[model samples]
Target: MLYQVALPLIPQVGGGTARTLVNYLGTPEAVFSAPKDRLAKIPRIGEVLVRSILANKEAALRQAEEVILRAEKEEVQLLYYTNTAYPDRLRDLPDAPLLLYYKGTANLNAPKVISIVGTRKSTEYGRVVTEQLVQDLVKHNALVVSGLAYGIDIISHRAALKEGLSTIGVMANSLETIYPTVHTRDAERMLQQGGLLSEFPFGTKPDAPRFPSRNRIIAGMADCTIVVESTSKGGSLISADIAHSYDREVMAVPGPITSETSQGCNQLIKSLKAVPYTRAKDLEELLNWDKALAPASLPKPVPALDLSGFPAEQQQVLRVLQQAGPTHIDVLSRHTQFTMGQLSSVLFTLEMSGLVKGMPGKLYGLV
Candidate 1:
């Protein structure tokens, strides 16, 4: 646990680098113990990073020990990327943080996770829509995720609480403090119902730059992201964009053109970056939530494919499609850990063999 927490504390070691080190060295402890010469030989390790790792190893461990002590005192759980408690939705994201601080009882890997985001300066219309949308989603048993900021973000959280649903507030700062202290009470309630999550450790401030990083987690940890309202620019749009890049579904609610808060969502829809969110059924259909909830006896089993003749990678892709139904290409790349070129080639081969069918929007499903 100490080494896992310490890996990210080393100077100049970003999430990607830390993951790379663990991938090559087998464990975080091995990364710290490896000789400088051995570390330097790994691709992209570079001389500077190798030296930094060696020189800061002890310091990082000391900082990690302190962090663990504080975490224990606060009853915070440290979620390393490989830990079973880590959100599966985020595990495959290349840029996901290596460690997260989580506190709450809600399952992080809930079957249905939906992020609700929008402008901090929300209007009455936005509030009504956000609340109604969440209420409608109760039947789907969706877990709500949001930034815990003012306006739509907080409204969504409060609405979820009212509806008896678990909602996670992904914060930019450490769990020790909630920004915009007015929402502290709501956050406390969330601790009992849902929970708070953050990649930053204790004492980290909610700085401007950290919000975008926080937005990615809100995007990555969910099956989809919905924008209730926003202006031309804001953290909500950033979250939508991140979700889109992850190949996760993104939905934006349409609003009056005259309203400034509606422009961002309008623009997102116009650019074909997001689907227009009208009602809860839109989500239920897009994610097959209704089908998932249907009685088991009502569904037919997928026929087994002859995977014995296919290459290992091809079989793996087939198996994923069989289990997940239709999946986007980018998602396939993440799940299979294959580069785009590699996944594309493999998909083409499968398509040619009639074992897979390519759908619109780069989605592929087993035939």
Candidate 2:
């Protein structure tokens, strides 16, 4: 399966063209066996790729055999791209891997899946959301997918592991090695829960260019790709774009507009290009997920800010702020634990206390 397909793929320029030829030729074996003159006439069968395919016949066969033996010993299932079990969504893509080496029990064709992506410099917001959203997805029968990068990517994968959820990690490197090196333990755990996936064969080192192509597969495999956070330019958005091209759902969570890391998501929402989702529920509603949940809800933002020591006034203020986004001091007081007259005094005191800040809308936040 990989040999004939690989011939066309190696040429770089004609990779897509060769993939198309295989689509028409029916199978790699058939393509390889076709009469030379007959194969030559096909557009873009170009001499280079055709000759490579013809010349590498023995090497391809030996490689395939070795691959099968390795998979069998490791208990990994080796799937040809054309196999019925090959992910239908992925198979449709132009650069889909010619073969997949998978471990674990989750179906590649699972009914619900979403890719979680973000930057290496994950903020508090990205980490919180990725952890929460992945837990939520797993509870609702959705498998989590990610690139296994640091920060948001690994946060999502680790959360899935904690939740006892199956997860998949797409890699920019070949199966022979780990890219970050630090995440090898996490990757090992993932092999038990899900599997590692990549288009590159063994010994392909992680490269700068491979990341963009790698990101596309992460996006293409999922029903939707959720960017926990990204800058105005990064691989996550590139993946999002490919997901959109594949007609998959693209949803982004909004963040403070000032942060360069979140600008991409906010821009996506503003353009009315991707769905805006703040919490796990937002994703579920968009995907129309209906399933039982076993995991705990996301931990509160202020886990250590226990209100136990606070008086009713502060507690009430926090409660009101929870219902509202950020609240004005006077309005927060009026809505809870004080009259309008008392509210002004509390507002002044709270302002002096430095627990909150004023915004144009009279809104306040816990500083």
Candidate 3:
């Protein structure tokens, strides 16, 4: 535990470098015990970084011990990346944090996970959408994930609690300090239904640079990311980008074209970078929620066009999905003899028409 926690603290040894070292050396303890000459010869270790690790080894070990003690006192759980209890989705990321300090009852590996993020200065529309989306997710038994910031992040947590769903707040700082300090009460409430999680250890301040790293956990822990509101640029957008890079489902709530907070969502949709999230069922369908759960969450059935009304090409696609059940987009195209781009447009129309649902891993099925 000491070596695992201390490895990432060594100067110049980031998550990626630590992972590389651990991968090559078999363990964090092995990396530290390897001879200086042997460490210097590892692909990217080089002599300078090896010397830095060697020089800081004692101090890092001390820091690690202090963190372990703090965890005991504060009731924090130290989740090593290799631990089975650590979030499985997050472990898939190449640069995933080596250590996480978690305090909460909610399972990090909850079957259904989705992050809702937006601007700290979110507008009323954003709040309403966030609340409704979180409430709707209850039927799917989803765990709402957010950054625990002002506006949409806190709103997401509160809505999840109100709806009796689990929610996780990924913190940029250590468990010892809540940044902005305003959400401390909300964090306390979250412990009942969810919890606050951080990759930083005790005594670590919530600095600006630490946020992007925190954002990854928010992005990586979930199966998808939803940006409720954002300007042209912000941390929420960063989270969306990271989630997309991880090949997770990305959705955006569209706002008025002129609203500053809506620009990011509009851009994401306009560029086809993210799906246009107009209703909660958009998420439900995209995530492939069980058919039985839909009736409980949705107010009404998705309005689907009769098979006779759809163009013959779309009807053909639907017929294939009906017969094949859930099938990959590539398989759909091959069976229907449609080109990839052509099949995509057909599927999009069918999806918007409520006849088809898209699943993760590029699979599609009838709604």
Best by TM-score: 1
Choose 1 or 3, whichever is better by TM-score: 1
- The residue-level lDDT of candidate 2 at 57 comes to 57
In the range 280-358, model 2's lDDT, one tens digit per residue, is 7676656545322344576457533466676777666756655675654434553674755566565566668776565
Clashes of 2: 2
Worst 10 residues of 3 by lDDT: 297-306
Predictions ranked by lDDT, top down? 1, 3, 2
lDDT computed for candidate 3: 0.86
Q: lDDT of each prediction vs. the true structure? A: 0.91, 0.72, 0.86
Over 141-160, each residue of candidate 1 has an lDDT whose tens digit, in order, gives 78999989999999999999
Candidate 3 lDDT over 1-367, as tens digits, reads 9899899888888778899899898999998788888898789778889889889998999988988888889899999887877997787467788888899999998878899999999999999999888877877789999988998998999899889998999998888787779888888888888998998877788889989989989988987899999999877999989988876789999999989999999998888878988887787777666454645663444345467877889988988887777886645765897866788899999889777888764788888
Total clashing pairs in model 3: 0
Quote model 1's TM-score: 0.92
In candidate 2, which residue ranges exceed 4 Å CA deviation? 1-19, 290-367
Give candidate 2's error at residue 308 in angstroms: 71
Candidate with maximal lDDT: 1
- Candidate 1, superposed: residue stretches over 4 Å from native: 293-303, 319-341, 358-365
Pitting candidate 2 against candidate 3, the one with the higher TM-score is 3
When 1 and 2 are scored with lDDT, the better candidate is 1
